[model samples]
Target chain A: EFDQIHNYFSLNPLYRASEMRKDTAGLQAAKNNMSTKFVLFSDQKPFLLRSEEPSRKYKFAVFNINQLGTELLERGTVIFLGLETWDPDSNAWFAVDIKEELSDIGPKFFPEGKYATPFPVTMQMEPTQAGIFAEAHSVLCWLDKYKFCSTCGSATKIAEGGYKRVCQNWECSSNKGVQNTCYPRVDPSLIMLVVSPDKKDCLLGRQKRFPPKMYSCLAGFMEPGECLEDTCRREVEEESGIKVGRVDYHSSQPWPFPAVLMLGCIAYARTSALKVDTSELEEARWFSRAEVAQMLAGQHPHGLYVPPGEAIAHQLIKSWVASSFSNL
Target chain B: EFDQIHNYFSLNPLYRASEMRKDTAGLQAAKNNMSTKFVLFSDQKPFLLRSEEPSRKYKFAVFNINQLGTELLERGTVIFLGLETWDPDSNAWFAVDIKEELSDIGPKFFPEGKYATPFPVTMQMEPTQAGIFAEAHSVLCWLDKYKFCSTCGSATKIAEGGYKRVCQNWECSSNKGVQNTCYPRVDPSLIMLVVSPDKKDCLLGRQKRFPPKMYSCLAGFMEPGECLEDTCRREVEEESGIKVGRVDYHSSQPWPFPAVLMLGCIAYARTSALKVDTSELEEARWFSRAEVAQMLAGQHPHGLYVPPGEAIAHQLIKSWVASSFSNL
Candidate 1:
């Protein structure tokens, strides 16, 4: 029932496209048409921009950031307000549940993840909300930890729609793009569901941060100069201590949860032994096909489950249990 | 006979999995001891370290750019070298052939788009040199274009092993990583081999840039909010004016050619007619399985051929011809 409710809630009309497009040329249309008021909140506190104060604006430039309007241009702008949320559930600052919108604001934003589709929901913050939030949050998270150039210890700056920064030291010359900031993006990752040799069970693990009774696939970022199988094999071996052979990809999902391309695969276990690494995992274990079926149905005996509808993990696990690999 | 040469030329081994770790801490054991250096040039171009004196001893950073060396390491001197082809057949630089050796005479010079890889392959550009070249060249080429911040018009520097950059605009919040520098590294793309209903023929298209006597899958990048299928459907319609229905996942490739994740699918064509978008493509036509097989084998009676090996399009076409869609 909860899953059913979840399904209905995700039926966002603003982004209800049957398919996605790579070249979206109409984002400028939405930006101008949808310039509304925004309350940028930090840690649940909202930052209000007062009138008569010539709205302070910031442009986060991503080179060729796919704007889906009028020739599929990629340049755009977003203004952010530093407001905290008075949130009750998390007991944090009052945050606006932008993804869980109950009201419809005018201005057709791109809904589909692909071209020219307006964003599914309005954050009710700024007209250019999600674009601003995602760029600022993901890039800044890296910047905070990377204040000085790791290579030369030179100071760096935030430049271009918060997309890039340059080195001051004349001796230091490094060029990096604002990927999550600039351009349309795809971040390669290795994620998979490991199956038992006998075909009766599958492997599942839980992170410490997961919901009370949820278990999803194990995943890790791909290293440079490596193929997807190499990544899958390496990640599975490290995370679960289970040897996998002949790893075949099932599908992929554009998981923009802070920017990652989740590459899903189904691997056959070379061995049944589970040498768990507790430090890496809060817990790890195997589940039967029947048990997995229940979890997908939300009828688990322990009320255990997989990821939500938006996650490819859920779709992947379901595909495995039903033996339908083309569901992507 | 040429097929054998074609096959041999195609089996490029760019990166070999140097090691595998059973657990996280096992990374220490996997460190420098695990990975192997890919031999870059067939002519053995040695990487050199810098010294003020011409007679001084030199040290070159050559080997697989192992992640173990880079994961916890943030600071290191990186050398950036622009491309200059060597005359492998003539023993000098003038008679340069693109297929010959690309020497890395590393004086440890730095400019941009040059960082230590997860594996350090100084000279070993093999089997997939084209793909490898595409990865390094495209990423660096794009970075070379952006030396300053577009926001407040300031400079930027590289950080995090050239994985990121920062702006010099102190007043700009994103200057401190408050904004995005770019989107993610990989761009999600959908490239489908549209097959007709009876399965007697398949659809293939060629861009102007493709080599003569070749055909490959049609592809485009995924946009901001679009779903995978959503992308496939739209790209199919837009490119060839042939609407597609019931798109299913097949496989994907990490097309390092400028960091694109090529999502491969076999779509059931909803229309037999294809009105070519000459603006987007040079030719669009149908090829029988017999022709495809010949193309893969380069035995096409009409001299029509598929893409070279080491390409996702080549693999996709092969997968379809062999009916490689059953197990899952």
Candidate 2:
């Protein structure tokens, strides 16, 4: 049986609703809310504040919308994520991107000796902060990369209160549909743990850029005109020359190193050949369930390990261990 | 047991590899190949040619890459989709977007009174043809809409053999990663068949744009920082005010009405109440198993019907019917 476990970057109770049709009104109401908080990002990194609590060393440096002043508000793009339902008051949060303005203005609002400092979002933030940052960073990256109309190469303007970008040229054909040129994009990817036919071992691979001795499940983007399952199977065969059968969906996670939806799965391999494609992976091999358990528990004698708990790779490995060894 | 059925959009045996690392050389070689075929799209609609066979009425208007003159090649974007592995000859299919150059050039190469005409991709093309068109149309639409860099409003050029768009600005920060602006996007959405506790009925809902008396599964985009199961549950509750408990992924389809990857699922409902959200749906309610079976078979007394076999909704209803009442 497939078990549902907590995957990092996947759990955020704060986000609410898909199509915020009244985004303009929502943004205005959120700005005026007494409990509203603003999260800031510059160059894809979120600002962090030092935490007084010894248990947690860092805290998200969130500010009241009014504290930033009008110049910063007018300069950057504003994205309304959703209400923080975890708090009883259900206050809203907004992510502001000031990468461009920071260069021109030289951190005026972010003065020296301030309470907060800009830090890489990849570093651990509070769960809620991480979720907000993921959504905000994805949108900011999208807006940063898509300023001109694709249909006519003309400049575009923010519409629907930062949820969309409309082409400025009236005659641009991109304006022909309800979708138009302003659609936000999210890339979908499939990540899977391939098990040998006997179910005694699972496949794992490492990339060159990965930290030493860290191996993770194989993953690739879901191409156009194919289902998630086919993508998973295709990726396994391509990376390791292992043909997978009987694929099962495990869970999914939102990975925001610039936005990708990772669909996690377990696949029963039909073929056992291990021909690792060097172009895709540095090395790939089968690991016994006991080894995976040792890696998960940080007790592996060989100094090999999986990714930290913040990634879906760790969750997939942890779940497999529990399922395979729990009866013992 | 959820039987893995052959879903229409999901069953393209043609797609070869995900990342075409040698796309530049690959495209040139494919062009020189004797088995090369080109798929054409304009404004997201595919061009269709009449089939001589009496059994099949229409086929994709495929052209030899060499037949299209240098004029068309210079003006449009060419995306190298994977090879047709299903065919013994392994022909390569290319999706070409001539939207911009079409009107000004006035179909110069197309030739008036020809054997082909432009048609909405929604209309049924041959199965393999439809799949190719969906893939081609999606790539063309993306290229058409993303011609300009979002970060600096600069014109972006097609890179990675038409798979990516690179901002012309040399110092753009988006160029930092191994993957920059050129990644193709596929939006993930969840569509579920919510079954009653007793398994006697299932919930279905219709949008305002749906045909009269046509109801299908409830679906919404998987929002940022959400798992597929949660997205399914959230959409059901929001649309019909019905609470879902256990969610299982049934199958997936590539819904290239401008590139959405639809994840089909089955949900066991915990609450029976139906409160339709007018803004999202026109109506929603539970229907008996027999009624759903009739609708699937085109025998509904009220003239109500689900979508055709090509759509994932049809597959979901069909699967549910076979599972629930096949033995009866």
Candidate 3:
């Protein structure tokens, strides 16, 4: 998955160039700022309902960006997965401040409210700094949520640069000095574009949260003991009612919006049939490669478009339309 | 890192010439009766302490290699992380496992009297069967260690393929999820051999772990709010008590044997005088290019050699000694 790019993790120090040198310096400047840094996170609160016998806890985080948070551009800004959604009825939700160059981001994304945190956060990052920060963000987010030991159900404590958590329940004894049961994890997922035999049309699906008329490649969280290709095929079939036969390899992207490694693949559809599950998705349909190119180029006669480049699904669809491969 | 040698990850879909032919027959043929199928992993788990102490209480899944586990060698064995040690005493510990050839796993890895429960986890895997499993192992180990939510002192619960953990304490209301902290969290570190204008030799130090008289490049862990060059300079000064400047990056590698990305760099020494901290390291010295060449060629009269190929330290030392700029 990290094959093509010189990820901060895989990059060899001896092979750096002039541009990368500047980028590294640029990133350090941001980290050393020591000033207020904007941290976008999910805040899920459980409240008791009078009508219900037991309290029903709603799992959510705020995806809303307000003037106070967005105004931190000059100070700093970072975005990641959160639980709260912007209540359209209220005008509280604001747009993310991605500095100046990414102005198009506000228009294409979050015109109403961003469904999730956008990728490639800013505030002076080196080329690979964002990726590293995202990696850290996912794990940090994970640690923030799981504070108690699951095995014995004891309150946990943090250690080692906020990297570890230990149980406080002395009687439980499930946790030691630096180890506990609740796990830190990365979700390995497969997001694929199902291709037609003639290589003319591609598969895309729309969900209720998607902006009106917006479509994207099929995707699903990988199940345990299942293969990537199988997951791809299964998700395609389940969402669009398509039976994938031969699955081709494409690319991968780390969507740390909530700790997911998006494994992108291309599958061959046995029969082009449309069966959309409204419960899961609003519609599933096949679009021609030309139509996708037009959408990507923003020249679609129907005024349709795909997701932006920050996502692997958008890249997957773009790859098919261009017959090009992305090294991510 | 990947710039020098792009491997399976870079090759994309054409994995080792295995194409996705449109036939289930290929799938069946790919399946093996004995060792044809096996669990694969990417994260290197050094099981230094198996069935011991705080970790001992935790359930570790191991196969007997009888009819169920190793007995299915035609299907192969599920290799995983478990601590192995030469001394049973608490003073020392090490993470151990078999990462060498599958044909060579020994009694050292599967010691006697360590019986584990077999859950009979059955499932069909696909395209790189070992990929996700490795992710699971790494993440699970991390969870076993990270008990508390680092941000807020609360308990956490596992979620999303063991990929995430959520804080249960309603008062704290922290929702962070997956983390990379574990028994072997990969510490992204940078190391360098500081050179001089005279170019007579570069700095190398002997750690407590190194054999007597052995010397290698000075290295240090990368700190937060620092760049690679900053790390190079800080590490050089911290270890040898020498001032280093003019840092240049060279290469990188995945030292996954407990999760460490080693960044190799070359630097200019501002001072020639050496002052060693004997507590952390045995000795600090500069070896001429001639001496290092003999060490690299394994003909050093003193029988001193650099680290192995799996480490970037050896590469850094060798590259500096063998480079045309050695005299500069």
In terms of TM-score, the best-performing candidate is 2
Candidate 2's C-alpha runs over 4 A off are A1-4, A15-26, A50-57, A69-71, A86-89, A99-123, A324-328, B1-3, B15-23, B42-44, B50-57, B65-76, B86-90, B97-123, B197-199, B324-328
Of models 2 and 3, which has the larger TM-score? 2
Assign candidate 1 its CAPRI class: incorrect
DockQ of candidate 2, scored on C-alphas against the true complex (2 decimals): 0.47
Report the number of the highest-lDDT candidate.
Answer: 2
Q: Where does model 2 sit among the CAPRI classes? A: acceptable
Rate residue A150 of model 3 by lDDT.
Answer: 51
- Which should have the higher lDDT, number 2 or number 3? 2
- Every candidate's DockQ is 0.12, 0.47, 0.07
Candidate 3 lDDT, tens digit per residue, B184-250?
2334456787776577887778888776766778776653323455456656765777877576656
In model 2 chain B, which range of ten residues has the least summed lDDT?
A: B112-121
Score chain B of candidate 3 by TM-score. Answer: 0.60
The prediction achieving the highest DockQ against the true structure is: 2
lDDT for every model? 0.49, 0.73, 0.48
On residues B213-316, what C-alpha lDDT tens digit does candidate 1 reach at each position? 67888887665334456567667777887777766666556554345556677787778888887877999888888788888997888798886555567866
- Cα shift from native, residue B128, model 2 (Å): 3.1
lDDT of 1 at B221: 68
